[model samples]
Target: MKKSLRFTKISVLLVAAISMSLTACGSTGPKGGAAPVQAGDESKLFGLSKTETPDELYEKAKKEGKVVVYSPSARANDAKKTFEAKYPGITVEVFKLKSNDLMDKLIKEQDAGLFNADVIITKEVSGAVGEEMVKPGRVYKYLPEDIAPNVDEPFRTKDGYANYLEMRTLYYNTEAYKSAPVSSWWDLTTPEWTGKVYLVDPLSSPAFMDLFTGMVVNSDDMKKAYKDKFGKEIELHGTENAGYEFIKRLRENKPVVLKGSGDVLDAIGKAGTKSQAVGVAVSGDERKIEDDGLKVAPIYDIKPKTSVPDAGYVYMAQKAPHEYAGKLFIRWMMGEKDGKGAGVEPFNELGSWVPRSDVKSKNAIPYEKLNMWTYEAKGFYTNSAKVRDFWIKLK
Candidate 1:
């Protein structure tokens, strides 16, 4: 009986050994798939070498065949159509997701040794790029030499990525005001405008947080605006600076805070509405003035500043499966390849301002004419937590 039991145990051990060997053979690469293309070498084939021309890069990308991009914009679909049309052999697969969700998925997948996305097109420079991707080496900096010169300083980061600017402007009901009644940023905090202003809830939207942080960064301008409007320097009421003072006053004024810009637009822009609320909205939302018959117009010529520039940045994944294709797509999106301004159509449709000096803005009001405040991406990343906490406490 002992000999029989020992034989059975030996047979079971052999079976287990065979199963382990088969599993080892099956697990060929990270995440148990075919080996991913080795990256990190400075080679034209891998899209790291900047020496390759657009045409050469296109050829290499075509050989790679596909690029998978994750973006927050639905415009990615339009871009996909244009890119695929331009390079018939290559396929561009875009996954549209919220900025935070995209980052979370990327991080989770990266931790699991899964590198599915080749590129990320997002406006989350401070939160996602600065805090997450760059810190962990999940993304590689790859700026093509051909397109590098055209990118503006404000839109290009030190870490080697490019961004396109979108304007967040103050909007008022045209019928209610006839023209924009508010000239300065401080005008909204007054008795007449109190409880009449609308804004997207800052706590929920990083863009709104960035805008508030932008106001803080440009406290000098806010100080001047305060002095100009109120005829005296702003007195901080348990706040740090003029920006915070303005925020505190604005909050105390009982302004309507909504979930989204769309809701704000609907409330403030709806025709025949009795409320004369003015809200902060994107320039793209101006299209609704005609489309929705909304009696809203941007306070474009307001004193000190009319809008904050929201910039969108793109990055390549560190372990990009199709690195060459990713690089090609980036270049194509920046309008470096064809020179006929092929890549910017999707952005144009959405009324976003391109940061490339050579690309002219398609907005009714030219970018040069607007009083614009720029967000400091690095500063926003570093101080966002503090700002968020302060804002929450104030609220």
Candidate 2:
């Protein structure tokens, strides 16, 4: 009888222990549960309060000893060196890859329960990051107090993460056209530009697709530009919006489509080139003109607009092993350490405009001249599929 009583007691204790363990796991929240963060509580958990000082963050970050970043730019390596120098003993490791590849790798690694990356920086925030990662709670949105006030609302997402702008403009061979050949976007579709225009294949580049979508979203502006240029209202060509009509017309014009922007730049910018092609590529590609002995310049003084600005976003991983370090790195990257922090130096090389009001880009075209489009995460995520389908059908 005594032996039977002892066995019952042991079983009861085992059950009590299991219940406690389950309770503990349940109460530990998203980090431990691998669930989406409670909406209102994210800032409290990921961001430093106004009262919290940088020294406090540094202490926590130093304890992690290292941070791993996945980005599409080799410029990340420059930021890594700057970050390490700023915080001795905390190492920064970067994995550079194309935007699509970076997203695939992160998703695959996260699925395998390998949270190797602490931070991810890429141009697909509106598409891949918003739809694939942020919506699913695979990453955390963090905005440092130092940077929060400096950035405008439109430049960031609802969650407080920043999106840095990259400008794309039309480039013309300086020798062939002393002045810009096209004054307005409509000029690209005219008979003179039928076979002389160059651009990346929209089906292959999400950035280029985003540009098209931006035009669609701003159809009113497109319509106005059309009226201003041609002295008449735009006649939609089997499409509801002027942007789509413009895209249809431009595509029909048979512009040279290339797989990559680099090739587009080469074809349009190479010195002594016989082709008088005007290509749309990253504004920063101007850095290559002199190096390649090409006399190419963007139409910075165009009437309605010169270029479109697309933003790249940065986010911390949901279950980052070095959460504090990731926060520190992001803060540093946003120019938080000092007014002109080293963390932002590499990005400066790309001539991309940062969201910070205080920081200025050294690109040839001024920020005001560019038609900047602040990325709307939801709009881009929802409209990308429809746009892609349209592009495929048109192509």
Candidate 3:
């Protein structure tokens, strides 16, 4: 009986050893199907051997350090705080300037190899600025799904190198045109509206540059029509002599050309009392003017002096000081959290304009239908030196 019991115990030990071996084999994955090594676990998230989200990218960038941004718009600090809160470890710095000054600064920094600019936030024309500052492949590609809903395909590049996220439209004095009878673009150049027009300096302001460029392109046909009607040229610049002809016309006409957008708005708000300047002003700024109880409106017609297409863009620098941080900031700025539909305050809406769309504005020209209007910042800024030379003389 003792011998039989010992044999039974040996049999049980053999079976237990075989079971343990099977369990160990099951835990080992096949070579290619093996899960990745996560920060804490061996199981890969999203079932991929390797793939990272913008959030994950943000975390990686935070560990790497800071981001420096250059923009021509206001409220940079607010944007920085929102980013810092989302990414607890990284730091963001902003350098804000007027659009033209921003371009000059970028060129100077690049030539000196200072390497500070990480990201850029400026008007759509600023894309041309990005084209100048960074090499072709160096700019990052990122387009968040949230911003996608508001943005159309034409304004966005396929690999996301360039995009138009926001815009500024043209505004008019509401008190002067009580019911806004000026429905079409031609109305601006009418005899009734003569000497009532005001324009900001197109040379210095990128927003104004967009406005004027649109006018020049859209007005070619209009210029011809007017020339035939008047039996001579309408003399937009002037029917005067030589070099300062255009300059003289702009100045002697008394445009009230001011230094910045605020000046234009300030002048428009008090147009009734302040020499009656029914000028061209920023649509966004006009909203602010009206919020203060001043009467103002925007005219989106396709006339010689029609409102221009304004688009805002964001970019990353190639020689960014905080490389990873720059990537993190781009993801933050262009992500769902800061985009249009997620209950987040959009820069577009705050500026009181539509994001890029096919929808037409009642008193404004929709980008789709304006065959004459075009926003070619690359053409203008690439030749900005030449344009500025002419502009200085004109001013």
Ranking the candidates on lDDT from highest down gives 2, 1, 3
Return the TM-score for candidate 1, rounded to 2 decimals. Answer: 0.81
- In lDDT terms, how accurate is model 3? 0.48
Off by over 4 Å in 3: 1-52, 124-131, 134-141, 144-150, 158-170, 181-186, 203-206, 217-254, 271-277, 335-346, 350-372, 382-395
Q: Give the TM-score of each candidate.
A: 0.81, 0.81, 0.65
In candidate 2, the residue pairs with backbone N, CA or C atoms under 3 Å apart (3 or more residues apart, or in different chains) clash, namely: none
| Every candidate's lDDT | 0.67, 0.68, 0.48
Using TM-score as the yardstick, the better of models 2 and 3 is: 2
Q: Which ten residues in a row have the lowest lDDT in candidate 2?
A: 21-30
Error of 1 at 289 (Å): 2.7
- Model 2 alpha-carbon drift over 4 Å, by segment: 1-52, 111-113, 156-160, 301-308, 365-369
Mind giving the per-residue lDDT tens digits that candidate 2 earns over 1-395?
Answer: 11111223354446435432121001122254223234455344443334234577689888889989998877778788878877998999998877777877887888899888888887663354654555455665666555666665554335435545676668888888888888888898899888999998877667787778777776787899999999999898789798788788988999999887778888887778745889888765656765777777877655355545565677777678887777778777877734477777666644466766666767754454465655665566656666667777886
lDDT, model 2:
0.68
Candidate 3 colliding pairs: 124-311, 185-303, 198-279, 300-364
In candidate 3, where is summed lDDT lowest over 10 consecutive residues? Answer: 21-30
